[model samples]
Target: MLIGDVSRHSGVSTRMLRHYDALGLVRPTGRTAGGYREYSPEDIRRIFHVESLRSLGLSLKQIGRALDDPSFTPAALVSDLIRWAEDRLARERELLERLRAIDASAPEGWQGVLRIVELMQGLNSASASRRQQAVLSRPEGVPMSVDVLAGAVLTEPDPHVAGALRWALARAGGDGVAALAAGVRSADVDVRRRAVRAIAEMPEAPDATAALADVLGDPDATVRGHAALALGGRGVTSAVPVLVGMVVEGTGDVEAAEVLGALSRDPGCADRIVTALADELAAHTEDSAVRIRLTQALVELPGTTAADLLRELTHDDDRAVALIASAFVGVLDRRSTEDRDG
Candidate 1:
């Protein structure tokens, strides 16, 4: 076949076929009377080999070596090509994400697009300070997306930076709740913790509350504690048990206690909190420290129920529990007296 026929048959263009001939990669094995290049069947087969290798992301130089060099082993070259293609794919994915974010921002023009890009770069900066500044210094009209802020919050390691990111995400409205929920399901403990923290800071969206409730069963104690504390504060009765457990274990016991107190304000959940605390007290009677923490948490409950529990705990066998409960009862009594006098 002539060059034109081979180009038509193989899909390799005429220019590229002649270039392959110039490189001595697929020279014709014969010529016509008019001195035109005539490719024999073997030459056409070689052209097919070069084009096949090119499809696998091999450069022209790489393809030439693969077809002509006996010493060129395909394994290493194939591995390198795989790595290159993976890198290109990763870059393409990143580009698509950035474009989507810009699109979501609904940038009005080139300036708005530039602002969005700058904010994105700042969020992704290696310096935590820069990342925080990116979130904090967002332009007034640029309309940052919640996903960008949530993504930063999930991966942020610096405490101050994470707090700033969470704050910014919360202020951005509940749009980031989906992203934060995704973070909650992450295998990374830190990511899960940050996700819950960020979600807790947002306005009470049902999705956020539901995600937090689902997290109560997480194996990570700190993560469960965070979720429970957030859910309890949201008046979620299901969080009462986890909060009660935190009280028993003394993990985030203060926040747990406060949230439990808040939940107790609800008439429906007040009795449940009291019962859970009472049960934990019985289950771990030998654990004085646990008893003391639970006793301290009891004071957080409203009305005379907690006072009554404190009165009973005042006579308990554990000296520390008795002293703490008695002290709390006395405080509650003074507050009651002051209320009556007013």
Candidate 2:
């Protein structure tokens, strides 16, 4: 077959076939009377082979060595090809994520796009301070999309930077709750913890409250504790048990107690909060530290129920529990007097 017939039959372009001939990847077996290139059946087969290798991302040089060099081994070359393909794939994925983030930002102009790009670069900077500045330095009127903020919050390992990202998310409003909600269920413990913490700072919304509620049973105590505290602040009665548990365990018990006291502002909730504390006290009679923390927590509860519990605890067997309760009782009494006089 002539070069034209090979090109037509094998799908290799005429220019490419000539280039392959020049590179010796595929040369014609002979020539016609007019001195045009001519290809035998075997030469046509080699042309097909070169095109096949090219489809696997082989460069022309690599293809030449692959077809002509007897010492060439496919193992190392194939491994290198795999690595190159993987790297290209990773770059494409990263580029897609950046584009998605920019698209999500809904930039109104080239300047807005530039600002989002700068913010993304800042958030991804190697220096923690730069990442923090990126989040804190968003342009005054251009709000970051919730997903962008939530993504940074989930991956941020620096506590200070994480705090700033959480603050930025909170300032952006509660829309990030959904994005953070996915992080709450993450298999990574740090991701889950960060997610709950960020969500805690979000303004109370049904989705935010629901996200907190979902993590109440998390295996990690810190995650559960943060969720419970946020829920308590939102006046979600379901957080009462977790808050009470935190008090008993003495993990963040002070903040837990404060939230319980805030929750107890409701007359109906006041009794339940007091009763839960009393139940913990009754259950942990032998554990003095537990009793003391629970006792201290009771002081934050409103109404006379907690004060009554405190007065009764003053006579308990543990000296420390008794003394703390006695001290708290006096404090509650003064509060009562101040309320009455006013």
Candidate 3:
């Protein structure tokens, strides 16, 4: 076939076919009487092969080698092509995400766009200090999306940066509770802990509390501790049991004790707190350390409930427990006496 016929049939441009001939990748082995380039059946088939390989992302040079080199196999080269394509795809996706984030920021100008990009970079910064500064240096008059802050909070590893992110998320609040709630369900123990801590700052009380309540029984003690503390701080009486368990186990016992004490201020919650703590102490009667922690937790209670518990602990079997309880009882007595005198 002539070059035009070959081009028309194979869909390969004559210009490209001539270039391919020049490169010796696919050369016609015949000529017409008029001296125009003519392609043999074998050459036409080779053109189809070259086009076929090109579709697989092979460069012209690679395709040349593949069609010639008996030792060359498609497997290794195809794998490399797949990897290259995957990397390109990942880059494209990331660019798309950045564009979406910038668009979502609704930047008013180039400066605003740059600032949003900078903030996004900062949130993903490897240095905790940079992330901290990024959150702290949030420019006034520029609104950052709550999703950005929430995402940073969920993954932030440094305590200071994480705290700042949490603060930003709370201030930027709108649908932030959802992100942090998802973090609470993370399988990573640390991520779950951070998620709950960050969620604790979210003011979407109903949603945040619901998410927190879901994780209250997490097997990771730290995760449970964070959830319990958050709920207790919010005065949720349902946290009473977790807080009591925290006190008995001595994990975040002091904070738990303080929250328990605060919750006990409510006449309704007071009896429950007192009863839970007392029951734990009694149930673990042989555990001196448990009893000690339980005794200290009692001091947070008011209206004589803690003092009454302390009095009972004063004559307990463990001498250390008795001494500690007696000392607290003395302090309570002095405070009680002074209150009456005043």
Of 1 and 2, the candidate ranking higher by lDDT: 2
lDDT of 1 by residue, 287-327 (tens): 99999999999998996777799999999999999999989
| Candidate 3 deviant stretches above 4 angstroms | 1-19, 34-41, 204-206
List candidate 1 stretches off by more than 4 Å: 204-206
lDDT of each: 0.85, 0.88, 0.86
Better of 1 and 2 by TM-score: 1
How would you order the candidates by TM-score, starting with the best?
Answer: 1, 2, 3
- Over 150-216, each residue of candidate 2 has an lDDT whose tens digit, in order, gives 9999999999999999988888863788878779889999999999998888865448888889899
Model 1: pairs clashing at backbone N, Cα or C within 3 Å: none
Question: Lowest lDDT 10-mer window, candidate 1?
Answer: 139-148
Mind sharing the TM-score for model 2?
0.92
Poorest lDDT segment (10 consecutive residues) of candidate 2:
202-211
Cα-lDDT of candidate 1 = 0.85
Model 2 lDDT on a 0 to 1 scale:
0.88
Estimate the TM-score of every prediction. 0.93, 0.92, 0.88
Per-candidate RMSD, Å: 1.9, 2.1, 2.7
Ranking by lDDT: 2, 3, 1
| lDDT string, candidate 3, 1-342, tens digits | 999999999999999999999999998998889999999989989999999999989999999999999999989998999999999999998788788777766778898888878898887778989999999898775677666677777777788998998888877746777757668778888888888888777756458888888888899988888888888888888888899989988899999999988888899999888888888988998899999899898887997776788899899999989999999988888998999999
